[model samples]
Target chain A: MEISTTKQFDLHRRMVRIRLFEEAAGRLAEANRLPGFLHLYVGEEAVASGVCGALNDDDHITSTHRGHGHLVAKGGDFNRMMAELMGKATGYCKGKGGSMHISDTSLGMLGANGIVGAGSPIAVGAAFANRYRGRGQVAVAFFGDGSTNIGAFHEAANMACALHLPIVFACENNEYGEFTPRHKTMAITDIVDRAAGYGMPGVIVDGMDVIAVHEAAVEAVERARQGGGPSLIEAKTYRYYNHHGIQNLGLKYRPDEEVATWKQRDPIFTFEDRMIENGVATREKVDEIWAELRQDIETAIQFADDSPYPTPDQIMVDVYTKSSTTIGTKS
Target chain B: MTRTASIVGMIVNPNAGKDIRRLVTPATHTSDVTKVGIVRRAIVAAFESGASKVLLMPDNHRLAERASDRIKGDIEVLDMPLSGSRFDTIAAAHVFCQAQVGAVIALGGDGTSRDVAIGWPDAPLIAISTGTNNVFPSAIDGTSAGAAAAFVASGAVCLSVVARRSKKVVVKIDDRDKSLDDLALVDLAFINSMFVGARAVRDPHTVHAVISCVATPASTGLSSIAGRIHPVGRWETGGVFVRLGAGGRKVRVPLAPGSFTTMEIAEVRRLGEGEKISLSGKTVLAFDGERDLPVSAFGTVTAHIEATGPLLIDVEQTLVLAAQALMFDETARHISEGNHVY
Candidate 1:
């Protein structure tokens, strides 16, 4: 009820942008423009868009390998992202850090980590720094259900709770940590239950509904900023695409019927339908938004294609500690 | 007549008991070794090795005194009077210099070793792993460590050969009363999102670093930025510092954090000496891999990378020699002949 019409509409637009971005990335991969493997954030856009919307620019966030939506929702630039995927000099890491390692610290989006459950400790450490400095900063770490099974997660949670660090653990329970379903890997169905072990609040939200996720995130972010320590929020969501490439080819672990059932809850379509029914937006307005996003993506692609490759000499940089006096010289 | 050697300095950490494997006691198998045993062994080893003077870096428990009384060698074990944090190994290094110890041996994991190294770059150090993660310390027996110290004391191996020094960065925050341990070699940030604590453990937000020159293996901290960049150091030396401010905007880069999300970098600048990089707020500075002091607001932290001087012993080399002696060697014969086997 606290959400205004404009905020809800903005969330809807962000969710669509994430979906379209992944869809386009998948197509670009097929065209052989994007090198390396790509993980699409097709179904879990709501979780990223909603949770990220709850944070301010100064708030920090750590992401997983499937972090495009998280990055975009956190306000990452599309042109730079496309340039990076193309491995152009203009890319974020100057074409050095590809998909898995992409980070924009400016946006409070800590770089997405490749290791499963590896980003948790770094987040905890950041939260500890924030608390120690007495800064009103909060840290958010986004991972999947697969990561919850990691021991590092448990240790970090216990430590964060014990130390009263301001952090929010957003677990996107996509039911699969790769090919294996949650039931196969974990005993409990609800990942939020993991929070009880840390002696903190655990929340479960309908991740398909962006509003639900937003409300949950707002509550968690406020609590953390106010020095209420940490909380665990499990957003039940799913991935429409395969773990990486385009081949779903009949999920051996999950029945075909289940996939069909979850697709019915596709966040984009649900939000669109709700917007039209509630008189919040017309089909034309939604179409306009999509068109704008598509055009933006096209511009991004063009920018990346036109951007020159980094100078060959530029190859030997961004790795070690560079001194101010030693600029232009190879370390 | 054999002249007894005097122990110049002893840098003892009380936490070495946290990670010792005891096969003799089945009940306490794989548990933390008793702190008293560690202290006792360290002090006794120092005494027997001709340590006539000692400087102890004990925890708040005053564990150094208990170890001093148990030693048979006539040695002066003076406790390092420390203020501020007990784990502030940097402060303790100043104490070692004041004590005028010829060599300083530290007992801790990579972070602890890095801490001591940052504090006393020129002081000789012996690293012992007592922490969970260890990449720098030599996983050797305490007796071997003691023997190695004695060798350094006896002029068996040159001091320059025993401690190898790497390049270090010194951050002097404008008007601040402290120094930083490790500046972020890549990127540092303050994260605000929430996930499970462990799963979110990724790299540090590196604000200022001498990235164009240093390199290391897969570290969870700043050095991993070098790993992300094409292996430059193993092939050649290179580094860069990317400033990531508080914006989620993507600066797309080719390097991936691990195997997942693609990263967007902000701005990449070539660092040089005497370059003035001003930070907005007083940010906390971490070094090598451990968190250090914070930079206060209105405080300016100048990061400059310079070659550090320390003759460090290679664990691989020492292990090779130890293996030769234990299996079959002239050194082993001499040790046995001298009745040095304990």
Candidate 2:
């Protein structure tokens, strides 16, 4: 997938943005500054960056619990994202949704769901709508390997294939399902095999390399957008932190050696090194990018801290209660 | 366990058949599932032939990990991080060389074998065909190839007599970095292009020249452009050199799957061992059908054939030698009274 130098720069920049954002959020969570659980996308940044790099600015995507990287790569505002994490009124959902539910309609990012496989149907539905409107917009559903076993995922695959919907099922196979190893819950080693039952073409790519992921995604996205029906892409990746937060719980779910091995293949650093070798950018440029993103995240944290909380009158503004009295509404 | 020759090294390329060529040509796409199945059969057969442990290259699809499921023997993955490029294969072969593995099984195309050769030139390789326009790999089944590999790895079948040491064409680019030095097992072609985009040489019109290590008659790909005119075999001491242009003899070559392109041949001849062929042009250097290093018009590249390559295992020959030694004889098995040496 012949990516120009400009696109290569964009890919690496987006990856660093995600890594920096996740690192800041992790620090906040560790310091007890954040309210809700933050599912950090630390080691799996390449999957989001590469998949989104192949997407158009107006293309739609449904994100999973570890969706911060997806939104950030899709051009989500840092200030609004940090505010949403702090539950401030200036957030993306006006403080109603935290990290897991953050979404920007302008960026065509559907809400990141807390449910494991719920994004599948939403992405499929969005693809159907896009096809109906004939705007040439493709929808990508980003989920984990564990979700491939879910009934919703299967149903979505079946419907997308049967209807020839313009959707791509992007599976970030991080080798675990929350606290459990994926092997314990699933029989198949490759999640791409699940797409075969629905007669959808499946592709497996290296999630640690942004170029590999972007190459595969470019083909799959093109295939879907050209009315070639849906395609499933499984990226073999790993998450650095525990599924929820940076603070390690007492429970040992995986081994240190495994974590150490994965850390050596850190997507952001590797891409920077690669870009330098390929003559795409200089080391100073890479360093500047990291510094800029770090400052941006810090500013975003301050913004979230300074923003006001939702007022009492706004408590029941977007929430539907269907009760006789409008709850939380002051006279 | 004491026979340091009990380990078999495996390199299964996940991206071999999955390339842009599939869209351009009617190439057979070898799904990761089918590759896993082939790996399973190969590893099991290696163990059955008395190999104690097997080491596999870790890939993105977890082909090694998946192939090792429920496998009784010690199926170890090389302790190395992946770069997700051709470097992964080279790194894995380097590890295998440091470990001094008995025999290595490569599951990919000519390009995959070439990568392994770069890491360990003296590797006892059993390269199985799993890519487009393959000439270095064999068409044998994984089971037989694995069994033969086990025989070689176990020192049961001697390499000196049964194995065929293949030939390779090494190219050194002057005015370029030392890393640009590369080799090809079958053929090295000069593609008339500036960038190595997509990696596959699809258009016959762009191929300017080819230098082949071993071009068997009736072969396909770049070698066939010369093979159809003058044949060369693995045991031969020399190579085939050809230049492509108009107003010359035209021959058909299957550059990809399900189709053929007739290429005009300007000149063809036998390239003797160590005979350096000079190439100076603005073109992409394609090693075994994969466009790798590019050359500028100011740089001069020299390519020559060498017998210093991998020791390719002869599956049928190794099995025949084993049968001759009563290793597969039922009478000998009965005489052993179920106290199997394996």
Candidate 3:
């Protein structure tokens, strides 16, 4: 599929937004400003940007723990997301659900699940809803390669195939599941092959290349929406930061050379180069977009900082429907 | 080679009737079995009324699938790949809008219809009451509701002729400058509490009801309080605002099924459409019987009624028109003449 200049520009802009958001999050974590675990999606920006760019506003998506990039790519309000990270009352969950649990149902973002492989079933449900309603909307589940081993992922895949649900299980093989490398954790080298077991098509794409991921996603999403059951997409990518915090935690496991090699293929720089080479965007224009995104990220951080924390009384609210007085009951 | 077919969408919320009210009040539980049966009847009725396709929203319990299993029409059970939640309803609404479905028959109460409205604000809806607090949807037979929906969906009865744009309570947080913060189909209550625990307004003393459209005295829940005092008609252009507190006229109100509470009404007044009522205090604002927003003592929340809600399909009116126009008779005659129809 040939991508238009406008679409290419949009892909580039989305990637830049994710990168800037992740970098800002890393800085805040380093400065001890953000609470809870901060899993940065630094180098994995292409997968989210490309996949989400191919989706309509009505298409639902479920994200992983390191989901800021996915949320940003799906047009989530950065101000509300940043406030969520700060545990403010103005957050998506009204401060009850922090970074790992942020959800904006209005935007078709099911949520950012803290548990491994939790979002797969959620995405399947969304896809089922789409097909059941005959709306032809697709749901995409964005997870790490580590999540592939979880039972929920396999169960969801099998169920999706059996029901011919319109869903895409996009696995971001960032090469690591927290501290353990992908090779150490799983026997299978390519997660996409697993789709064959569930009787669905599978594709592997260069996670560092926005164009490749976008093209593959467009095909997969279109096919799913057109009644073609589910598909598994393995995005071969790497994460720049440590699994959890800004601290590298000694970087004792992986070879230093591997990190250097992956950095050389940084998705943002590669995509920017492609944009300029294709004459889709000028270096000046890309730079301007990056600069503007940086300003936006700064504003978001300020908003989060200025936002108030939820009051004690709010802790009991939103636990269920808005009115039951069931909170604080030991039973 | 080509045929135009009307599609009617059905959304069933299995979680609607299974609320805290089941444990607290004498409200009857609507089992998954009954919901499935209702959906099946609705689908069959829609097909009989010339709906060529029936689209059902998938649920966790396989409600829609089971309902459509024995049916042989163009029934498509939506693919919900994940576990069922309220979001599924909203997502299905978006799909129905995209598919240009003739009309939607929502099988739940106010909350279920609200979810559909959120997804497709102007969708033509046949809201059926199957939940505890049901003020928006009426207690109508599924078969009749489906037939009416089919008439609207298939263009046998014009939408304008059979439906009217219902009223909605548009809520604004703080200033009335921002976009509509939230909305409620029947009632918006400001409760003198901070937490939204259990989600239902159990205690009558905690509520200050602001209702749009009509609240029948025969109905139950918070809307009944307003209906009992100052009954507002469905087409009335304004709303009723009632303050509940001490040292006021006492009135017996049924807060839930088999649960009647005497509420002290401090004040009750009629507010015209577009007239803003500012609520400021340490409270939580409950919409459509569920508490959702928490307002600080200094915070101000504004609410006003507007004719911007979903176009509710009058089932009786639609069926009546279909009869008067000989739609049912035409189908019967066609069948008697051995004229095959899909």
Task: Give the per-residue lDDT of model 2 (tens digit) for B35-116.
Answer: 8888899999888776777999998667899888998988898778886678999999999998878889999999999999
- Best candidate (score: TM-score): 2
DockQ of each: 0.01, 0.08, 0.01
Ten-residue segment with the worst summed lDDT in candidate 1 chain A? A245-254
DockQ of 1: 0.01
Q: Against the hidden true structure, what lDDT does model 2 obtain? A: 0.84
**lDDT by residue (tens digit), candidate 3, A1-331:** 3567888889888888888888888888788888898888889988999999999999999998988888889998888988988888888887778778888888789999999999999999999888889877899999999999999999999999999899988989887888898767765556765776787767666788786687678867888887777887778889888887576568677778777888998988977775674456798998899889889988998898899999998777889776545678753
Tens digits of per-residue lDDT, candidate 1, B279-314, equal 544444544433344444555555655445344555
Better of 1 and 2 by DockQ: 2
Q: After best superposition, candidate 3 residue B66: deviation in angstroms?
A: 1.3
The 10-residue segment of model 1 chain B with minimum total lDDT is B20-29
Model 3: runs farther than 4 Å from truth?
A1-331, B1-4, B80-83, B175-180, B330-342
TM-score winner, 2 or 3: 2
Model 2 ranges with Cα > 4 A deviation? A248-261, A277-279, A287-295, A320-331, B1-105, B115-120, B131-133, B146-163, B171-182, B187-271, B277-303, B316-342
lDDT of 3 by residue, B112-145 (tens): 8888988889989999988887888988888999
Tell me each candidate's TM-score. Answer: 0.48, 0.77, 0.50
